[model samples]
Target: MYSKKVKLRFVFVIVFLILIVLTTFTVLKVLKDNVVYFKSPSEINLLSEISNKKIRVGGMVKKDSVMMNNNKINFIITDFKNELYVTFSGTVPNLFEEEKGVVAEGFLNDKKFLVADKILAKHDENYMPPEVKKSLGE
Candidate 1:
């Protein structure tokens, strides 16, 4: 039979281990909170309650909708059903053009424009990499 001291020590060790695990889990959860997720303009409605959070907006660059002013370029991204205005201040990607797919990363501004820090042009399905082409049976 274990002595009272040994029983007490065993309980203390188990409690200490559980506390350590909980503390580690809490710390990791806090860190993960800073990471943001991407969404389309149509998906924005699903996250209406979570405004002012950083996110990536992916959609087609609206045709004849890009307007330039000094260093800022304002454009509209559309997902066929919904659209969002976007403003970015940087050199556009090589593939960036009207009626092309684009993914902008930033947060929505007070004026409802997506202030993008970067823009990524999406490739066309007709000219995909070999792996993607094979996956789609193209």
Candidate 2:
């Protein structure tokens, strides 16, 4: 047996709690869709199943693994234990080179290869873009 005012307050609190829970759930669901996991070539190669979801793969570009055909660029990322091939059509970063650190964002294909949408190159201090080097003639 609850009084009228007490029942109204209880109902208000329940509604507020439900709204908070719904809002929290919605935010987490949205964040989950945007989350991308970063993995190395060795880790990817060991997966039981290949996924087509977008992901970030980071490793050193293998020596003598870079090749260009027409406008497309193909390279192999290696963790020294395993290799993951990557295909990118757009212009690559200036520091992208064999034996250098690179991260590619893209989808995995049937051959466990990455079809890169973007390529990011990591370099040390004293690094220069090819365009800059060309303009400076060095």
Candidate 3:
């Protein structure tokens, strides 16, 4: 037979251990993997530090820089300081065009071209999405 004090202590220990496990799981699942990536060209120039990190790279599609051959489109995105070549084969957004804001999600290949897994077109200020605007720090 256990004393009242021992039963209370056992219950407290079980609850305390459960709380610790739950807190650790929540922090690892939500806080750790929910990182949002933001970058401009000059910032990306420092990519050697975050090169392996999946990130969001934003810049303007250079005017007359977009070239298309079949389903593939190649263009230069510039942040006014640096430029990166981007290649996307999927259907582009309606706003995707030369001299427009674009965010490409992917990794930089050995060829220096961004192999975009996703392409997002940034609209004008009056039409900007709240998330994109916030990402641009606007």
Candidate 4:
């Protein structure tokens, strides 16, 4: 025959575990909807399905790729191995320029181009986001 104390302890442990599991599940589900992953041009190319979800793409602005048309700017981002075109109508950071590290936050248009809502440029020659550096391998 099992003692009452042991049965009570087992029930308590089960309830505690269930509570922990439920909390973890809820947190993960909430984060899943909010999470936006950063990708490079090459990674974007491999994606089979493109969505309008907000995301970030980081890499170097290809040399001589920057162009201006009235208030709009267009550029190409490259990971050396692959490249992606990006267009933005907003004011760009002063540090933004060709052949510099930049991260564009926006939605991809059929994986061929990114319509950026924000453009983040590197602070200096030596600074780059770790995610972007890893993607560029430099």
Candidate 5:
């Protein structure tokens, strides 16, 4: 025989917990929908099925595998075990070049080809801007 006050408090606490759980689930669902997973060329080569969803593939640009014609650029990304051909029609980052690390965001046309919408160049941990390098004298 709990008092009326105790029942009211229990109900309020239950409602608050439900709201919290709902909010958390909503946030997680949104995040999951927007997440783009990164995979290497070797990993992609092992996929059993290619999805239409967008993903990011990162690896070193194969040497002399880059070719450009007007706005479109084609290159090969390699992880030393496998390679994925990428075609992008846009301005590329300055750091993008042969033998550099790159992450291309786009949909995979197949296990060996990717149609990239964006290109992101990655630098090593020791990389420093020219100005800073000049100042540091090494």
Candidate 6:
């Protein structure tokens, strides 16, 4: 028969383990909810169903596919194997241009189209911002 002190210690250890497990699970769940996955045009095309959740689609902006109408801008992102049409109604970054790598954060209306709330231009490692270049006198 274990003493009262031993039983109390066992209960304390069990409670501590349960608390740790619950905290870990809670943190994981919050992280999962906040994570925004990035996908290419080809990967998006392979999706069986489109969800209302937000996602990021990254690829090269197809040449001659950028068009502006009023406050909206439309462009096509292609991964060589597939293309996704994107519509955005905000000022794009200076680096955003045709034939450049870009990532659009938004919701997908279908496999072929995305309604972007934000646009992020991606550049190669060799690229530098104009301000930095000027400051560095390069």
TM-score of each: 0.61, 0.61, 0.61, 0.64, 0.67, 0.66
| Better-scoring candidate (lDDT), 2 or 6 | 6
lDDT of 3 by residue, 43-115 (tens): 6676555465556678899998999999998888898888888888888899898888999988876324678
Across residues 1-138, which tens digit of lDDT does each residue of candidate 5 receive? 999999999999999999999999898888973554578998899888999988899999999999999999999999999999999999999999999999999999999999999999988889778999899986
Better of 2 and 3 by lDDT: 2
TM-score of 1: 0.61
The alpha-carbon lDDT assigned to residue 136 of candidate 2 equals: 92
Candidate 4: worst 10 consecutive residues by lDDT? 31-40
Which residue pairs in candidate 2 have backbone atoms (N, alpha carbon, C) closer than 3 angstroms, thus clashing? Answer: none
**Residue-pair clash count for candidate 4:** 0
lDDT string, candidate 1, 66-105, tens digits: 9999999999999888888999998999999999989999
Candidate 6 Cα outliers beyond 4 Å, as residue runs = 1-37, 128-138
The candidate scoring highest on lDDT is: 5
Clashes of 6: 0
In candidate 6, position 78 carries an lDDT of 96
Off by over 4 Å in 1: 1-37, 110-112, 128-138
Model 2 lDDT tens row, 28-115: 8888735544688877877788776788898999999999999999999988988899999989988899999999999988445899
Q: What residue runs in model 2 are displaced by over 4 Å at the alpha carbon?
A: 1-37, 124-138
